[model samples]
Target: MKQPTTDISSQQAEQLLQPINQFLQCRTPASWIEQAKQPQSLPILLKDHMVCELKAAQSAMLLIRRYAVDEDSGNALLQWLKPYEDFTYRLKGNWRDLADHNKLNKRMVPKSTKPYSQELIDKMVLLIKEELHHFYQVLEIAAELGVSYDRITSSRYARGLFTHVRTYEPAALVDKLICGAYIEARSCERFAAIAPHLAPNLGQFYFSLLRSEARHYQDYLSLAQQISDTDINPRVQFFAEAERALIESPDSDFKFHSGAPV
Candidate 1:
C-alpha cells in the first residue's frame, strides 16, 4: 500500500491542537509518547485504538438511547449495535460483517418533543456511524500489519472522568457529554502528538483522522450545552481537571491515553 503523505509541521500540529489544548488542562506527557512510538507498542496501540473507536460509537449510541430516544427506539438502537458489540465484547463475530450494518437508518427516533433530543440523536448517530467505520478500518490495518486481536484492559482515562459525573437528570447527561468532549479532544490531540513518531503509513492515517476527531469534540460540547438549562461550563471545567489528573498521574499499565510513565 502506498503511504499517504503526513507532512504536518510541528507548528501546524500545534495550531490544530490549540483549541483542544486550551480546552484541556494538561498535555500528553513526552514519556507516554516515547513509550507509544516504540515498534513493540504498535500492536497494543492499534488494538486499544480500535477498541476506543468502537467504544466511542457505543458510548454515543448509549447516550442517544438513554437520553434522546423512546423505549421502542432505544431497543431498535440496541439491535443496530448488537452485531458490533458482540464482535468487541464477546469476540464472537468478525469486523468484516459490519459492512452491512454500518449504514444507519431511522431505527432510533427521539421520544420527546424536546428540541435537543432530536438534535442529539442526529449528531450522535452520525458520530456512531463514523466511529464504527473507523473501528473497521483499524481492524483492517491490524490485519495487514499482522497484529492479532486480543482484549486488553481499559485505561484509567474514561473511568476517572465518569467518577465525577453527578447522578441527576440532565446533570448526569450533561456531565457525560462534557466528559465525551474531553475524551474526543484528547484523542485528537494525541493523534497529532504521536503521528510524527509513527511510521509513514500509520502517521498519515492518524493525521488524516484529526479533522473528524476535532468535529466529534465540538459535537459533544454542543449537545451538552443544548441539553442543559443551566451553564455547563462549570461541569466542563470539572472534567477538564479530572481528565488532566488522569493523564498526568503515574499509570502502572500503558495504553492509549494512559498517564505519565511510572
Candidate 2:
C-alpha cells in the first residue's frame, strides 16, 4: 500500500499509521477489502459511509451536549444536526441543505460546575465540526459516483463494542471513549488498507482521511485516560480484547467495520 502518493509519501503513510497499526489487534482481511471494492458493494459502501460520518458527528455532539455545554448550546447542537437527521431518518431534506446547518453558533458556553467534563467541549466540538463536514463530503462523493444515499443497516461492530459499556458514571464515559478510540482506529486502518484498491479519486479521499481518523483515535484515547480517576490501562486492554473479537469473529453483516463475512 504505497499509493496516496500525491497526498503523502508511503514512508509518511506508514509512519502515520504506525500507532494505529500497533493499537489494533489485526489487519483488515484481504477478503473484506475485496468485498468492499466489488461493484455491487459500492453504493452500499458509500451510503453507509455517509451515514457513518453523520453518526460520528452526532456522537461527538452528544458528548458535548450531555457532559459539557449549557442547555442553550445543547439545543443549538441539536438544530445543527436536525437537517442531517431529517434526511437520514425521514428522507425529508436534500444534501444541499446540509452544509448551511453544519456550523454551530458561538454560544457553546461551558458549564462551571462540571469543570473536568468541560474539556470534552473543545475536542468533541472540533470532532463535531470535522465529522459533519465529512458527512457533506461523503454525500458529494456518493452523488458524483452516481451512488444514491438510501436506508442502510449498521454492522455489528459498534453495537458489539457498546455492549461492554459499564452501567455506571465517569466509568461509562471512559468506556465509551475507549470504544470511540477503537472505532476510529479501525476506520483509519480500513481506509488505508482499501484505499489502494479503490479508484484514484476515492483512494485519495480515503487516504486524506487517514490523519484525521488517526488523530481522532488518539483524542478519544486521551479523553478516556484523562476522565478516568483510576488507571485506564486494564480497561483499555479489556476493550482491546473485545474489539479484537469483534473484528476477528465470523460476521454476516458487512459494512465499513464488519468482521469476517459469513
Candidate 3:
C-alpha cells in the first residue's frame, strides 16, 4: 500500500511526543503497531476508540461535577452529557441524532471560590467538548467502514491505572489527574505510532487527533499541579511506572489501549 504523506516524520513525532514519552515509563512496542495495522483490527479498534473518547469526556465531566461545580451546575453538566451517554450506554441514538445536539447546555459555575475551581471547569469543559467531537468522528469512521458499534468489555489498560489511585481527598484527585495525564499521553503516543500504518482516511483522522490528545495530557498535568498542595512528582512517577508496565507487558486480548500482544 502507498502510505499517505500526512504522517509526521519520526524525529518530528518524537519531538512532538517527547513530553509525553518522558512522562511514560516505557515506549509502545513496535509489535503492537504492527498488529494494529492488520486488516482484522479495524472494527475493534474503532469501537474501543469511540468508547475511549466518550469515556474521556465523561471522566472530565465527573471531575468538574465533583471537585469544581456547584450542585446546579453539576446537574447541568449531567444533562449536557445525557444524550451522548444514552447513545453510548443505551444504544438509544445514532451519530446524526448526536450531531443535532452538539453544544453543551450551559457553562459550569464553580462550587467554591477557590482559584482552581473555575480553571478546572473551563479546561475540563473544553476537554469534554473536544472528546465528544472525537467520539462522533470515530463513529463516522466506523460507519463509513460498515462496522457496527459493538460493545466490547472495557480494557484492563484503564482499570489497571485507576487501581493505583489514592483513596483520599486532594491526593485522590491529584492521583486521578495524574492518571488522566498518562492516559491522554499514551493515547497521543499510540496515535502517532499507528497512524502511518493505517488506511489513508483513517490515517488522516488519527493524525488529526494528535494535537488535541497532546493538549489533553498537558491540561491534565497542569490541573493536577494546580490542585495539589505539594509537588506531585512522586505520584506522577508512580503512575508512569504503573502505566509503563500496563503498556509493555503481555496481554491476553487485543484492545485499543492494550499492551503488546502475548
Candidate 4:
C-alpha cells in the first residue's frame, strides 16, 4: 500500500518538528532527557505515560460526546467510562473495575442518525481503543518496574489550545477539532524528535507511536472538513499558529505536552 502523503520524509518531518524539538531541548535540562534514556528513567516515564493514555482516552470520549453522540448515547458513554474515571479520581470501585482484565471490543450505538455517521464512529472508536490499549501498556510497564501509580497535576498545554476555542456550540466543535489536529501532529512530531535520544526499547516504542499519531491528526482534520461546508484552510492556519505559540512559549512544567523548558 502506498503510504499517505501525510507521512513526510524523515527530513521533512524533522524540519516541521524543529520548533517543538527546540522547545523541548531548551526547556528540558540536558541532564533530564539524558537520564530519561537510562533504565531508571523507565519507571517515571512509564508511569506518566500511563496517565497520559487515560487522559487521551478521556479526551477522545469528550469529543465523541460533544460532537458525535446524541443525548442518550452521550449518557451511555458517561456510564461506560464511570469506572475508569472513579479509579483515576481515586474513588473506590468494584473489583471488576480494578481487575484490568476487561477488553473494550464492543461497538458503540449512535442515538441519532443526524450527527452520527459510520465513518466518524469508526475513527473515534479506533482512537478510543488505541488510547485505552496504550493506557494498559503503560500500566504493564509500570507494574514491571514496581512503580506505584499516582495522579499528578496536568500540564498547561491542552488548556492553552482549548482557550482559543469559540464559545458557540458548532463553532466550538470546529475549533476543538482543529486543536485536536494540532495536538496529534505535535505528538507525532515529538515521538520522532525524542526517538533517537532514547534507548533501544524506548526508541522503538516512540517510533511505533508515530504512524498512529500522524493518522490521528489527519482524522481530526478530515472530520473538521466534513462538518464544515466550506474549506477549512483558514481554521487550520489559525490553530497552527496557536499551536506554534504554545510550543514556543516558556513553561515551568516538563510534561510530554509542556512548552519550552524554563
Per-model TM-score on C-alpha atoms: 0.93, 0.95, 0.93, 0.78
Give lDDT: candidate 4, residue 132.
69
lDDT of 3 by residue, 1-262 (tens): 2223345555766677888777778888987888898889988899999999989989999999889988989988888888888888888876678886667777677866667998898889999889888888888778878998866789999999999998998899999999999999999989878888887667867877777888899999999998899998988888888998999999978898999987
> Each prediction's Cα lDDT score?
0.85, 0.84, 0.85, 0.65
- Give me the overall lDDT of model 2: 0.84
Model 1's number of clashes is 0
User: Which one wins by lDDT: 2 or 3?
Assistant: 3
Question: Which residue pairs collide, candidate 1?
Answer: none
After the best TM-score superposition of candidate 1, give how far the Cα of residue 53 lies from its true spot, in angstroms. Answer: 0.7
Candidate No. with top TM-score? 2
Candidate 4 stretches with Cα past 4 Å from truth are 1-44, 91-107, 111-116
TM-score between candidate 3 and the true structure: 0.93
Per-residue lDDT over 239-261 for candidate 4, one digit per residue giving the tens place of the 0 to 100 score:
76777777677776666766666
In candidate 4, which residue pairs clash?
27-261
**Root-mean-square deviation of Cα positions for candidate 2 versus the true structure, in angstroms:** 2.6
